[model samples]
Target: MALALAAPLAACGGGSDDSGADQESIGLLLPENKAGRYEAFDRRIISSRLSTLCLECKLEYRNAGARSDIQKRQFEALVNKGVKVIILDPVDAHAARSWVDAAAEKGVQVIAYDRLAEGDVAAYVSYDNEKIGRLQGKGILDALGSRAATADVVMLNGSPTDPNAPSFKKGAHEVLDGKVHKIVYEQDIPGWTEAEARKKMAEAIKDLGAAGFEAVYSANDGMAGGAAEALKSAGLKNVPLGGQDAELPALQRLVSGAQTFTIYKQVRPEAETAAEIAFRLLRGKSIKSLTPETADSKSKTGIPARLFNAQIVTKDNMEDTVIRDGVAPANWICTKELAAACKSLGLN
Candidate 1:
């Protein structure tokens, strides 16, 4: 899907450049390194596509490691360095607004990537975040089947500072609130950190007892891993867990029947789309026609966005979704320990 430019081309520092003599620089600000995919997949994908799309383009990248202040500083540094476009996965959605506005003032185009930063950004590229949550919710309900009516579940959501967390939580609650016997406990994991999720899960298990909850609604794979750690420590087994991102460990857990399902957003397209848009804007070309969808941001309306679809992946369909599609390599997922399971699943 394409996204029309939300802000005017001129407003984004675009100007006539028939000769293409100027060397353009694009800045990528990622939120954290704790999530392996941000650096391993997202950065590589974005940089690779940018290099292919604009051979001469200079790419400057930084990870905030989930620190809002550090991201703020990084944004300032990029703006001061006069990069043509900045693709930002904000550490704090609301806090990133000022940085977006600041970039606007300098005529540097800002493209909100992965997580939407609330401001007048030139473009936004991400999946339908609420849909991701809904899929997770439905995966849990489906895994539980009729047992959902009698099951107790606990929600371990993402960082409260990220705006997407609320939408995710809201979507999950919509499907889970009245359908389950009890929502034993729910808390937003700060920084979306694995350790925090582990601690919260352990606490929840302790208070509610191992038998109290049947499913875990973890927001992403990192937290799912943490919850798994806690569950293992408590001697809990075969608990249905929902996650997103389809990280390696999560996929492995799904194969082992530890994690029920994960939502795969397919980051390659997202990164490529963001890079394509930034390259066009850098070269003084219009992108209004490329972006077909518009989304509402907290401080702005009609933000041009390329929203991708997210898919639900279980052990049964991993081959068709992530592996067969080449999103995750068979060799990477079918490890030594997972050999038997992989062969049983027809992964080899």
Candidate 2:
């Protein structure tokens, strides 16, 4: 993989540390508020990890709402306000390069979050995006079973501007390449927004010509929900759909048989690891040896990165994955309405 690094502090729309001394604040910029996990997990885990390591550091947080323009503007704002180290998950990888360039120019370090940003960064952290796509493809194929070669799967991919989108598509295509029957609809949802997904999926159903599609391969849980809604409108019953991020709603849908499975990336480990990297960078320390893998970006070469493993999560195995990993507990999923289902699944 080729890496492109653009840590331009000037193009960041003014978010950089202009203070005379070395005192630094850590700015954390996430992509969107639409995904529940960012607020529910990523921010808390990263902050907690940072706090555990040191108390002097300050964490500045912001959301981009799946818009590259907003992110570019926000990046400038953070730098202008004077943050020492920036942890950014790009809203649009390529568009982010200019802002990243600006940050680099200001001498403030930038760490690429879960979603890999284009260009040079202090450090990069994320799961194997290709593996996620492969898992999703395999899960959908496995669900199709005898119909794997016969079924027409609709591909609901992630944002076009996001670098993960193509990697995910590549991973999935590796499994689905020649064996699958057909791809009636292959579309990338912008910003991973539910509304966009819903609209695109409806258009797909119309394009596929009513009841012509069999299964769906959605990149994440949010789009999966949108695809599910579109399928509901089409009045199709029991066609397997794939998703990632074992979100509460997706888990419920799996239990109800509306969805087939999801790719569960142990988020805590990623967030914790990122926190550690950011803190270490803040201390002016080296983090090269700590990373287990090397990721290539367009602007930079061989950036040391942490790539976590992704697991397949289904209704039957949620206990073994999320429950065992402490990512989620039975209390939330095993509510009064789902008490029987929880018991049936052997989760107390």
Q: Write the per-residue lDDT of candidate 2 for residues 82-190, one digit (tens) a residue.
A: 6668899988888888888878988878889987787668789998999999999999988989888888888989888888889999999999877688888888887
Once fitted onto the true fold, the runs of candidate 1 whose alpha carbons sit more than 4 angstroms away are 1-23
lDDT of 1: 0.84
Backbone clashes per model, in order?
6, 43
* Tens digits of lDDT, candidate 1, 248-347: 8899998887788999888878988998898998888988866889988879989888888898999999988888767677888888998999899898
Look at candidate 2 and tell me the lDDT of residue 176: 88
TM-score of 2: 0.90
For candidate 1, the per-residue lDDT at 12 reads: 25
Candidate 2: regions farther than 4 A off: 1-22, 335-337
Worst 10 residues of 2 by lDDT: 1-10
- Would you give me the overall lDDT of model 2? 0.81
Point to the candidate with the largest lDDT.
Answer: 1
